[model samples]
Target: MTRDDLIAMLREQTPACGPARNALIAGADFVVWDGLVPANRHAGVFRTRMRRSLKRGRTVDGLANSVDILRRAGEEPLRTGSIDAVDRSFWFMIFLNSTATAVVACFGGRRPITMESAGL
Candidate 1:
């Protein structure tokens, strides 16, 4: 969808949804899922990091769980990555899945949220 399309959806949908995890739907965008990490400069970083970590025998958190929660709460996964941007909390984007046709959510909170969006 176009930027206008995203903004229109945000305007109409966000207010109705209200706050989630202390988040207000700041905005929305039509974007590709990138998985780059340590500086997410690529779209495939989501899958890549997940795969790499798993290969190293790391126990990944239930990322799918987080996605499910976000979707149920009316959000879509955009760029998945661990960012220090949330005051010790990790952040990820949910760009309003097509079903909702609504606003995107940047889901984050103390403790590791989930790795589903973080994984490839």
Candidate 2:
């Protein structure tokens, strides 16, 4: 989908996934992309390998819950978005499954050294 369309879709989502949806979609200093590209280096989503997964147990932690949620999607397409926000920048990921579910998650943090001098 087009970048604007993708962002618009994300803006219309509810709290099905992350608790920080509103802030994530608010006044983004930089536009988020489906994947990291040269144009915007600070925020993007991409398919990633979960290094460590917390298996099922009697009790579940936040990480476990997130894992289990994604697990239910099985081998279905899943993309994780990692944001390294500098100041008012923003980032988030939209996960879609076969059951027509959408899980949105986001985070913000200091921009990396690579983006220090790079223009938005």
Candidate 3:
């Protein structure tokens, strides 16, 4: 899908609460990451690494809500899209599988109070 389409879709999603809400921010770039080295899984892999790294905020509230948005658009299998992080605080991603399922990941910040999640 086009960048505008992706942004629009993400905009309608359940945004993060508090100041860092509105996951879709101005000047952010939306891209299809299905072509890089690890293919569509690039963001996911990094998420896994982050989960294993300094912080793993999967169980925390407000973090894992983005995946619900991704799952809603899971009809397109094996597709992936990512939103460039704004303010170096957070980035969002959506990955679709062959089973017509999708997962969204949104994370930001560095060390200490980092936010990470892959909502189902």
Q: Pick the candidate with the highest lDDT.
A: 3
Q: Which stretches of candidate 3 lie over 4 Å from their true place?
A: 11-25, 35-76, 96-120
Q: What does each candidate score in C-alpha RMSD?
A: 11.2, 10.0, 8.7
Per-model tally of clashing residue pairs:
15, 0, 0
Model 2: what TM-score?
0.35
Per residue, candidate 1 scores C-alpha lDDT tens digits across 19-115 of 2222323332225344422222222333465567568766334333333344454322333322222333433343344443544433323335467
Per-residue error (Å), model 2, residue 25: 3.8
Q: Could you give candidate 3's per-residue lDDT for residues 14-62 as a string of tens digits?
A: 3332222254445555566554232233444553554565364344222
Between which residue pairs do clashes occur in model 2? Answer: none
Q: Candidate 3 — what's its lDDT?
A: 0.42
How big is the RMSD of model 2? 10.0
User: Which candidate gets the maximum TM-score versus the true structure?
Assistant: 3
* TM-score of each model, in listed order: 0.28, 0.35, 0.41
Candidate 3: lDDT of 26? 58
> In model 1, where is the ten-residue run with the lowest total lDDT?
15-24
Q: Relative to the unseen true structure, what is the C-alpha lDDT of residue 101 in candidate 3, on a scale of 0 to 100?
A: 31
